[model samples]
Target: MSDTSSRIAIVTGASGGIGKAVAERLAADGLSVLVHYSGNAATAAETVAAITAAGGKATAFGGDVADEDAMGRLFQHAIDTFGGVDVVVNSAGIMPLAPVVDTDLDTFDRIQRTNVRGTFVVSQLAARTVRPGGAIINFSTSIMKLQMPTYGAYAMSKGAVEGLTLILAREMRGKDITVNAVAPGPTATPLFFEGKPQEVIDHIAGLNPMQRLGTPQDIAEVTAFLAGPGRWVNGQVLYTNGGAA
Candidate 1:
């Protein structure tokens, strides 16, 4: 079992952004991490390097999150590398902004495939394989509650994520596993800045009472809690958005 004393985590989409921050934080909290990336091997390696350099343990792995076979292997690989899985953080997602009428069919499908199917695939594997007392943390967006325009497909995808997260928590029964989703509001990550202009960004930032976009670190703190000591906080979508929702 390759020295199973330390807890282990599988953090998808960890090559950058919110995923990366969660990986680093979990490692800092003393869990060995499997840093999963979709296509950015270089950045994934960098994430691994940073962890190891900080006297923490991490490895970079790549695969399509929605691929059942691929993600199944991913779960196995985590067990092989770190004895067993204690946490599975589904931080991999896509955000495409377009009004419902203007959103392309292909784009909507792509968003759902990655955001919804990908989460389902990983969460399914986590449901089956995560060791007792483990945690499965899924990503969602507070934008869904805001009901903003130009986010129809994105919000729909996140709604599915929330539903899957809650039901899976119940299905796990007395397994000692906690399933929950973290819904962040306008975090300052590459994903959030991809299409917004400066003025629009400022306007949205100002809307929050805090008057700023959430940082990746802010969200990571909540994830760390859920993965570690927040055992009673299950089957809930925590709005970790500084009241931005």
Candidate 2:
């Protein structure tokens, strides 16, 4: 657990559950993962060949996180392939259940354009390209504190990502970035039993109270401890859910 942050991570839906376990735990704590993916480019090249066959330092990218020119060419292909972009991680989303009177305004605007405007266009490009001590995280759902019931349009798009991670941690305070928002609960992804049944996925994995169901490395170890403890845990949303709420 030592390779300390030199920084360079992108991670949006990195081709699997919880963005491939937060891009292999942020490249096993070293951080040089760009992974990202939209239409599974061969499972994002098998999550960059299993993070370069485990010697960590990944790459595989793609786009369409609600496309703003494919998120500015996915942050210009992670700043021309790993040279900038500190840590973004908005685990690309979609959870369609309906039930707000059978909601459908084009499925609530395509789940608020991919979970609230793809985490506000990747936190407005990590608030203008993160670098100075960067970190953004943002993916949310413990069914918004378990207010479950066909998951109100995926908890109203993760309640606008917990109010946009508290207004982007007060709009990146002094730019010493740290935006935070990890809400995971019922896990066991395949997009959380994507078409349910199998006794409704064994009753949603026994309604999680540690009765099981949550492990994309359990929300990638609380998003690798909020992108490596640049602590103060700004803005905060952290539900990680074994308690199930």
Candidate 3:
């Protein structure tokens, strides 16, 4: 339809994985999307192309999610191009598996910068800029609930995102904005497959009642609901892993 009448979404880290799925799903739902990528413009282009080829509106923008200035521009670009933003999905994150004692200080710092500070930067901007009736969705992980080893450092960062999601929802009481986080369980993404043997994957998949790994579309369905009809799902984290929690 028309640009002025359509909802607009900015899906950070939309180059692939859950981020790409969210962008495509939102676009399919009639929202014009700005596909944001950190260092993967080509893949981000694929996301945009897929949306457009399906008769949905989309374009890619590259920027560091952790940089406040860059993220501010991203918000502005959405406003400038699509009239205003109705949804913001902070799905960009880095997961480096390590036990706390074995975690390198540098890697830990990098995780904090991209996962924690990055979510904060984009979130505050969404708070100020996303139009009323909009939604802010941040990505956390099931690791927080899994209590699994080698995810300690990553879990710590997501804990902060959870705190931010809940507090922001309350802070937006009169603003009519919903702030929620989607903590997905084990999913089949390229990142998830790295270095894992088939047996290990099968074991993890079997932990859930569904006895399968979640697909990116599984997470996207929950996100699409929150961004649209699920307005009451605010200030909460939806564990969307086929009962994998």
TM-score, per-candidate, Cα-based: 0.97, 0.34, 0.97
* Higher-lDDT candidate of 1 and 2: 1
lDDT of 2 by residue, 1-245 (tens): 23455678888888898889889988888888988888779998898899888888888768878777888887888888777887888989888896799787898899899889888988887889987677888888888778978888889888888898898789788888888888888888898888887887777778876687887997898898888775678898888888977
lDDT of each: 0.93, 0.84, 0.92
Per-residue accuracy of model 3 over 41-136 as CA lDDT, tens digit each: 899999999999999998888999889999988888898888899999999999888779999999999999999999999999999998888999
Task: List ranges where model 3 is wrong by over 4 Å.
Answer: 1-5
Q: Model 1 Cα displacement at 221 (Å)?
A: 0.1
Clashing pairs in 1: none
Q: Candidate 2 overall Cα lDDT vs. reference?
A: 0.84
Per-residue alpha-carbon lDDT of candidate 1 for residues 1-245, written as tens digits (9 for 90 to 100): 22333899999999999999999999998899999999999999999999999989998889999999999888888988889999999999999899998999999999999999999999999998999989999999998777889999999999999999999999999999999999999889998999889999999999898989999999999999999889999999999888877
Instruction: Tell me, by lDDT, which candidate is best.
Output: 1
